[model samples]
Target: MDTVLTTRHLTKDFGRLRAVDDLSFEVKRGQVFGLLGPNGSGKTTTLGMLMGVVNPTVGEFSWFGEIPNHHVRKKIGAVLEHPIFYPYLTGQKNLELNAMIKQCPEENIPGVLELVELADRRNDKYKTYSLGMKQRLAIASALLNEPTVLILDEPTNGLDPMGIAEIRELIKKIAANGKTIILASHLLDEVQKVCSHFAILKKGRLVHVGPVDDVGKGAETVEVKADLPDFTEVLMQFPGTASILPENGVFLVTLREDFHSKDLNAFLIERGVVANHLVTKRKSLEKVFLEILSEPR
Candidate 1:
C-alpha cells in the first residue's frame, strides 16, 4: 500500500515515432505525483498506457504492487479527455447517471457533489453551469466510485484564472483527504504548487525526476549590486564568496556551502560596502524545466 503504482521501462510507439521511451517511475501512497512536460512530450500517452487504454510497445507496470486487473482498475478514477455530460441534465442528475454506469451507489452522489463544492448548485442544469462548474462536475463523476487513486490530465487546461484557482484548491483538498493523485500538466507553476514529487518528460523520455523542493537546490546564488566601483573586488575578500560573475550590470555571486545572504550582507557592511540592491535569486521551476529540455538528447 505504500507504493501505489510502478512502471518499469514502459514504452510505446506509433509508426515511426516513439511516444514513450523506456519511461520508469514510482507513485507513492498519498503523494501528489506530477507528470510534467510540454505538449507531445508523452504526458497523456503515458497516462493512457497506465490506464490500460493504450497498450505499451514493450515493458510493464503495476497497480498497488500487483499486475493491473479489472479489480485494480476499480481502485482508480481518471479524466483523460475533456468530459462530456448531458447539458440539459442537472448536476445531481448527471452524477446519478454516472453512478449508475459506474455501479456506485446513488447515496455517494450528495457527498461527491459536496466534496467538489457543487452541492449548492447540484439542482442546476449542466447547461446553466459555468466552465468551472462543468469541470468540477466532471471530477465529481470520476470520484463516484471513491477510487483510491485519481488521475487528472490537464484538469485546468482551458479554464479562466478563477476557474484554474478553483480547481487547484479542489485538488489540494482532495490530496488532504488521503487520496493519491496523479496529475499530468504543462503548467509548471501549478505543478510546483500542488505536486509533492514530479517527473519531467521530453520527447517521450524522462529527463528529470525528484521532489519539488529539490528543483533548484544546489549551489545558491545571490544578486548583489553596490554603488562602489570596487564592489566585486570587495565581495571576493569575503570567505563565503564562492564565485562572482557579472550579469546584467550586477554581480551574480555564488555563496559557499555555509554562506547565506544575511551573512554576505553583514560582511559587506563591515567592509564599508553597502549594496544598493541585494537579493537571493531563488530559481523557479520554469527555469529548471527549460534547462532540462535544452540539454542534448
Candidate 2:
C-alpha cells in the first residue's frame, strides 16, 4: 500500500495543443502499473515528464514523497527506446561495458545475466542472436544497477510472436522480484498479460483507472427469453442462478463456473417451459478495453 509515485493536476502543453491534461494518479509499491492509450494519447509525453526529460507547463509530480533528482533517478532504471549496443560485441561484453559507464559493480553482471536467462548465451555476438535474445539482453542491461523501479516504454515493439512471449515471461519474472513497474504501451494484450492495475487515457485525459478485475463483466453471461409472461417467476425459483435481470425483452442470467447454458435449457425443459432465444458472452480484458474506448467522451 506504499505510494511510489503521485501526480497532481499534471499538465503538459506544446504551444496550444495539450499533450497531458490535468493527469492525476498514484502508482503503489509492487504494482505493475500500465498507462494505456492509442498512438497519440500522450502516454510517451507523460513518461517523459516523469523522467525529467520534458518539462511540464503546469502542475507537478513526485517520486515517493519528494521531487526526483540524480539519486532518485539512479534508483529507477528506464528504457524509453530500443537500446542500440555494439552489434559485434558479445552480450556479456555489452552489459559489462554499460555497467562500467553506470559505475555499477561488475559483480552484479552474472546474477543479472542469469536472472534474464541469458547466461548461456553471454558470449554470443549481439547481431548473431535472435530478436528475443536481443530484447532479453536489453533487460539484463537495465537491471545492472539493481534498481528498485523499472520504466519500460513499448518493451516489445519490434518482435515476432515468439519474441513477444519471451519478453512477457521475462517481465513477469521481474515483477515477481517485487520491482514497481511503470509500463507505457498501446498493446492491450500486453497490458492484460502483466499489469495488475491500469489507467486508460483518451486524448490526453484519464478515462479509467482500476484493478484488472474491475473490468470483469462476468465469466460468461447468458441471455434467455421465453414466450410465457411469468417465465421470470420460474427462473427465479430455479437453482444455480447467481443473478437474473430483465433487459429489453430478455433476462440476463449469470451462472456459476460449474454451470453451463445447456444446464439452463435442460432445467427449463424439465419445468415444461422453453426459451425462444439464448445467447452467450465470454468475458475478456480486450472486450472491456474496447467497450471503454467506444463509450462517448
Candidate 3:
C-alpha cells in the first residue's frame, strides 16, 4: 500500500518541556488511522507538525511521500482544535468564500454541503445553526479542496451524545470513499469503531502501534461455569492460562497473549471436565487502551 503520511523522529519542545518525542509512524493509503492519547499526550502536537501549524523542535514529516510545504499540505485537509467560519454569513456563503480561498471549484460546494447533510440549510446563517450543524459545516469547508487525506483533532469533542454519533457516522462515510483519515482522539471506543490502525501515545512517547484487530487477537476473556465442584485444578494445568478469578459460581479467565477461547475450551474437553456455561467477552479497544495507559511511562 502507498503511504499517505509519515513522521520521522518528530519532536516538539516548549522551552524545557517536550511535547512530542521521537514520534515516528506511517499512515497507509485508504486507512483510517487513529492518533490516541490522554489530554496532554502529544496527539495535537504531532498533528500540528504534520499540518505545518507548529514547527517541530526536531525531526521531519511528509505527506504523500513528499516533503512538508503548503503545496503538499493543500492536498491534506486538517482541523486541529475547531474550524473557523464567519457566524454572520450563511452556511453556503461561508463555504463559498472558503472555496475561493482554497481555490476549490465552485461546483464542488453543493456536493460537499449535501455530503455533510447541510444542503437544506445552506442558505441559513451560520449563527442560527446548532453546535452539531456548525461542526458539520466546518467539516464541509474542509472538504472544499477534496483532499485525499483528512486529519481531525478531537472531532467529537464537547458535543452531546447525538452529535458525537453524527460526526462518527460522517467520518465513517468519509472513510468509505477511500479517503485516508488520521483522527486524534481521547476516545478509545470511537477509535475502535472508526479506525483500521492505531498508535498510542503517552507523556510524549509512543507506547503502541498496530492494526485495531490485533488488539483483541488471542487475548479474549473467557467466563466459564462447570458442573464439577472444582474445575480450577484442570484450568491450572493449562500452560496457556494467565490468570483466573472466581466470580460467583463462574470463573473469569484471562489467557496469555498467545492463547484464545477455542484453545481453552478444547483443553477442558481433553481433561474430561464439562462446562455448563461458557462465555467469552471479546477484547474491546477500551480494554487494550486501558492496558496501554496503565503501563509504566
TM-score of every model versus the real structure: 0.90, 0.77, 0.89
Which 10-residue window in model 1 sums to the lowest lDDT? 68-77
What lDDT is obtained when candidate 3 is compared to the true structure? 0.88
Model 1: pairs clashing at backbone N, Cα or C within 3 Å: none
Writing each residue's lDDT as its tens digit, candidate 2 over 152-261 gives: 88889888988788878878988999999999898888998899999988889999999876666445678899999898898887776888889998999988777788
List lDDT for all candidates, in order. Answer: 0.90, 0.86, 0.88
Local accuracy of candidate 1 as per-residue lDDT tens digits, 104-200: 7999988988878899999989999987778888999888899889999999978999889989998998899999999999999999999999999
At residue 222, what lDDT does model 3 achieve? 92
Top lDDT model: 1
Residue 220 error for model 2, in Å?
Answer: 6.1
Candidate 3 or 2, higher lDDT: 3
Model 3: how far residue 233 lies from native, Å? 4.4
TM-score of model number 1: 0.90
The parts of candidate 1 lying over 4 Å away from their true place are 86-89, 120-129, 245-250
